[model samples]
Target: MSTESIRPLIGISCGDLNGIGLELIIKTVSNNKLLELCTPIIFASNKAINFYRKSIPDSNFNFQQIKDFTRINPKQVNVFNCWEEEVAITPGQLTPEGGKYAILSLTAAVEALKAGQIQGLVTAPIHKKNTQGDSFPFTGHTPYLKEAFAAKEVVMMMVASNMRVALLTEHVPVQEIGPHITKAAIVSKLKLIEASLKQDFGIDRPKIAVLGLNPHAGDEGLIGAEEENIIKPAIKEYKQQNNAIVQGPFSADAFFARGYHERFDAVLAMYHDQGLIPFKSLSHGEGVNFTAGLSAIRTSPDHGTAFDIAGKNKGDESSFISAIFTCIDIIRQRTAYRENRANPMKKLTNRLLANAVDEKIEE
Candidate 1:
């Protein structure tokens, strides 16, 4: 079959309407080439999309609107209208309407994903403070998805062409970070990162580097005891249990400064800024935030709502575009991993079968 016929249907949730989510989505999907890779189903109303489209100068972006999946057009951009009523969209301003619609779009797309209507999801950025209410009380997409899908745990992984970084604790306060960094949490994140690398990234064997919670990696116990008491013990246990090539508790400053991160397939950071600071600096605004360990695939741009430049049309869509492709790539990698594991001899059998057919033709 042609690639387009077999392309995965990717669902996109319109983040906070007041932010640059819609603008980025319009710019990313404007490239018709993306349609060939995967059919995109954006969960938002036509009115919201049109409002952003008009802001872009000399733009001709277009999309088909559908209230249900029955009329989905695989060859065209599909807008799955979550709401029909007109809502105020004040770009660069935080409002309750924006949060309500953002959640509406998210819940609609998520339900479609759960029902197998979409193979993967690419979420736009949402304002955490405004998006939180009695209906949704999660910190971010990772935690919300974790609860929605009933995933026991999920690692918020940052992906770029250069490197992959996963966080042990995301969106946690700096003061409260210490209590969350424990032996159990470290090992759990390591396990999730390894599995995600192998299955999601198609790595046969992944080498993971762990960053320390304290400065100078506890200075070999002078700075803090997390490295010796908590971090190192967790690494040792994980290595022994899996026979995996996992090492670290490296000083965060030195690790990135000296380019030690290049030596491993992935890096595990103890907290949010510990991993993201170096990652964002190095990614050059082309990073994707991926939630690993979930049954369904979900990815988003590494950056958040750029409220400052929301209505100015100054938001960059590169990261958002990367998120879309990353979601698609992970879906393909998972498929390949499962198929290969299911029938390890499938490739060899195909080659032998081809040779036998050749012999018959020669006869």
Candidate 2:
């Protein structure tokens, strides 16, 4: 298939409908300009959409409801009813029904993703507490997706305009983070980070900056020993195994403050807040959460469902829009990456073309 003709079908899960999930989806797809980039398939019921459509009464967004994937309109926003039965949707109210339907939409979308019906996924915010059930008992999307796809490992990386930050330990208690920061986990995360940068982001050689668990990188072992015992050894082991550029047990405070993040293509933090705090501060509300090392492409807004502004037509769609764009870009990049690997002649042809251009330049 020609690259130009291959428009990815991006699936979006309507998160806690009571929250701002439906509102954000409506606002994002309202722009006809977005339909040109990728086909958006919203996994939501018609009832849920109607609730938010009435709340935000000014949007011109419309959806083409399809019962089958083959009937999807590539140029129009599409909605696939995950459940046909009626479900109550009270915007700004938290209830079990909100979580139940959120899981239903997510489950339907994930099935499509696995069957290759969708090329990528852009998830709206879901209430982590209410999203729990027998089907989904995990803390958040990363773990749930990891189990669903049977992926060996995954990293939660937040992408902003300036830099990309990944977490070594996600959604763990502060006291428990110390125990989870082992040499094996750090090394595994490093491998995943390097592979993701090259394949997903198109970086030939990505330099990753790793942060210390304690203050001032353990202050040469005085402050803490995680840097000396676990982190430093892990970096050394990773360097010996791969040629990818890996550096630091740098103090998190100074690394971000002094703009050292710019020196590397991505940063690896010890825990969630350590990386996310800096990323969100500089993201300008355009950050996207990307799960790396998955079998499929998935991205979500860095922020959660803003229940405080639910149904008020006050939610900003910038981050959600950025998530869609990021998911599409990654899907395209992954396709090109796989194709080049499958047909090595393409790489050789490109190298010959480069050398020819260099010779002409010299002349």
Models 1 onward score TM values of 0.95, 0.94
lDDT of each model, Cα atoms only?
0.90, 0.88
Model 2, total clashes: 0
Model 1 alpha-carbon drift over 4 Å, by segment: 346-363
RMSD to the native, candidate 1? Answer: 5.6
Pairs that collide, model 2: none
Clashes of each: 0, 0
Instruction: State the lDDT of candidate 2 residue by residue for 1-363, as single tens digits.
Output: 222265679999999988988899999999876765678999998778888898788899888998889999998989998889988877888999989889889989999999999999989888888987676889999999999999999999998768999999999999898889999999999999999998898788899999999989999999989899999999999999897689999999999999999889999999999999989998899999999999999999999878888999999998998898889778766766776789966775544533443343234
- Tell me how far the alpha carbon of residue 319 in candidate 1 is from the true structure, in angstroms, after superposition: 0.3
Candidate 2: C-alpha lDDT: 0.88
Query: Candidate 1 — which pairs collide?
Result: none
